[model samples]
Target: DMTMVLRVIIRNRLSENLRHRFLLNEPVDVILMFGQIMQRNSFTLMCSSLRAHHCPDDVNNPVKEVCPQDTDSRDGFIFARDIPDRSTQSYRVQFRSLILEKKLGDALAIHDKIVSKDKRLIDRSAYNILIWGCGKYGYSRKAYELYTKMKESQLAPSNVTYTSLFNSFANSPYKSESLKLCEKVLRDVKKFDINLNYINYHAMIKAYGRCGDILMAFDLVDEMMSKKIPVNSETISFLLQGCLSQTESGFILAIMIWGKMKQYRIPRIIQHYNLLLRITKSCGVKEAASLHVFLMKNPTFFLPISLLDTESNASENTSKLLPITKKSRDDSAFSNYDSPEKRYNGLGGLDGLLAMMKKDKIKPDIKFFTNILELVPDCDTSENEILNAMSINKVQPDDVFLCMLMKKRCSYNNYEGAKEVLKLFNEYNVKLNVLVYGILATTCRTANDAKMYLESLDSNEIRLNVQILGCMLNNACRSLDYQYIIYLMKQYKIHKITPSKQCLKSLANAHKRGRQIELDIDNNVDVPKKLRQRIKRISYKHFVMSYRPWIKLVRNSEADPWEQFTVKYEDD
Candidate 1:
């Protein structure tokens, strides 16, 4: 009965379409209809008749031959898939995947293909994706160009569009240009009656804050407040950071503004507290200590929600809900009777805070320890606290923690202590990276010791990046080792690394110190041809020439010239 009803509806609709075209004196060429049962004879007959009106030969054409195959299983990478003219969602999915994978070239090509294939499916949302992708990957210029194309296409940019573009510009070198664009977007918001939100203001405020225009930043904050947009903690932190390098007046201004934010009940985060400590660092050690002490004493502000409630309630819930068993069989089971004092008897300050977390069954991560260590001066006490946390498995010992500990020790000229820390890393089975080696190299007492470490790195076949190579070059130059410098240049050639200007300059200094005036122009790939030729002309005398003077002063008059040059050069 339903099939009969559907057939009747199709027949009537087809009749009405034909009548409408005839009445309008318009020619109808092709008509395509979609339904569940295309195999039905009635549907096939109707389609064939409709085709016969325009092409008599198509009356006998098979429906299967005319229709394309179902392409439902062809999902692939962005540029790998054939363009589907009917499915815009497929295109969007592929494009988003390419963006996520940072395949910018493929994403752009697919975007262009999508535009050319189906203009109707290309909306403001599609343009927003392209723009956001470009912005996120540091192509703020290309993002602006995409915005221009969007405008030319008569598509009004959304608030999300403005936010993405503003964020990219804020992070770029063109912060000044971003400010002007921010103003223009504000004007557009007013003209087009688009909703303005915190994201729109965040970039503008941050740009102004970064440029040290604290007044403008505050003015924007006022503007946001006047419009009833909430000024969040991140905005306040940026304002505080902007005031860092200024004089006492700027510090006073920052304090006044912070007080105002507190009065307004703007919620603060850990970063805000950390920024306060950083600001006070410039004032004096005493001020910074006082700030930390004040923050620690007021534990309620920084405490997590789980710690805010009475410990008895949490313990009671855990004790009742957990399955009770023999203590021997369930050694890892929670003990409801544990006291806060028993848990944190020796820990204080940040350690005490971490102990509180442990008692609350909260896990403290490496970042938590890193933040505390950065603020605290006593590495010995902090290291003990971290080890305690590790003993309870509240925090896992990792390379990051080891690196931080070693760095603190090295900073205080405790190289032996730092090396001991590395041994702890090995005990923990933590793999060391080049950064750890670089930091250890910094603690070397003499240039030869540094060179020895570098040689160890090379012997291990560690991949030498520019940073490690620069460190090696610095030590070699300091030792006035011209032979070592030539070896480093050879290393650069082997690695196919174009030596940076700084590295070359260090090499020049090494040459000057070693009295090797003339540059070796042949078979060296590190120095540019022009630079080498110029240096050769300037430092006209070579180290071989120096050997001639030394030989004239001390060599036997009858000695062979070549052997004398070789011996004197080696001795020198």
Candidate 2:
């Protein structure tokens, strides 16, 4: 309401002939102060600071304050001028600042205000600035809209604008729409006969890579090489990110892509190496573990000796000092994790990452530990390393880990492991929240075991939630327990709790097997009619929860955590 009122006042008082004109017969100082306040407060320009630009070479530093240059005063516009008229260029700098700071809403509002006040204020430079901001900020649709708007305003989008448009897809979460927008941008570029540059080609390659068209991305890379533009670190990083977006399914492809970097002779950085670890995470635990060993053995891959490896006898007498892992007991043969291309010689997933961190003497931080607790839950070695690293850092176990560890462990029916993790949490004084206590109940493999756990816990300390309720139903999953699954579906009316997709999926699995189970009633029974009804009703309810009158999901905009938690509460 205040913003609307302010806009109305500005429109009424600020004349279209804004050449030193003032309304209300106010003093010059008051008029200037009001103008400053409107621009600063209303448009939010006061809170921005100029930083890096998307295309570093294209940006020019702002000059000192100067008098306003008329948008069209017969002088031809210089797109690459270093000393721009301050009144116009200052705003451009401010807009770029907001963009770099990721204040897209503020930047958009300011751009619209400038356009409304004087369309002439929006020259090709300003349009490019706005387009670039929208593209960088995951607003691909908005970026596309602004691109069309530029054409309608008789302002042709230059190569920079096209590059920004391509970037709109590169970072976009909406891959399909971004690809469509990219196609439109390509058509416009061809239609305009605008010559392409290295930067433009790179941006298009990244866009295609991120949008899951790695073949297209590869073609562009080939084109860049054909045109004598060397494949650089940035290009390799973009391809790595593309592989990451596809998850473990792209592991072989990633190896082939890594060969390209090797082919071009680009040295691997911490970022690229880190990306490799994340991509390898999906390639079975055994393969990933071997990769870790390979990376640690290689001196060329940044050899700061591990804190453990410091002992002279650590390598030679390692078997005597260390306990055997499951991998060693089962299959002792050495193997390589590679695709058709043997270029990516040794790339491990989470296990390799831990080894790399140990070698670098980089004590893994709490954020890294917490993120991987989800990513590589079954890695016992990683868990032990995380604890040791925390001990070295002297950081306490986070309260979240208490609850979260239970959820992940219980999902796998690792009851003993869940109990051990909770004990570790207790040693560090982690609070026993409802999430922890409830999920702990489900950790027990059998309903009788779960009932015993529930019986043993103190009533005052254990409060039940959807997660707890899910646990109570012991919604026995991933194994042959079905009592909790059927029981949970029936109890929704008596208990107010959100339905989880994990539980829903478990129910689907049970339906597939048509397995009958022993209910607490001491007789075997099949879950048929009630299960079907609840599935239909809850499925519709969950849909309503994910979709609504408001634009995006509440998981993002409205801080609706309950819905978010239940949506992705469990991995399986």
Give all candidates' CA lDDT scores: 0.53, 0.54
Per-candidate TM equals 0.55, 0.51
lDDT of 1 by residue, 358-452 (tens): 44455656666665555566457656766786677656667777887887787777778888887887788999887787676655444456558
lDDT of 2 by residue, 363-405 (tens): 5555555555655545557567656766776656787765666
Candidate 2 — worst ten consecutive residues by lDDT sum?
Answer: 45-54
- Give Cα distance to truth, residue 210, candidate 1, Å: 4.4
Name the top TM-score candidate.
1
In model 2, the clashing pairs are none
Clashing residue pairs, candidate 1?
none
Q: Give the TM-score of candidate 2.
A: 0.51
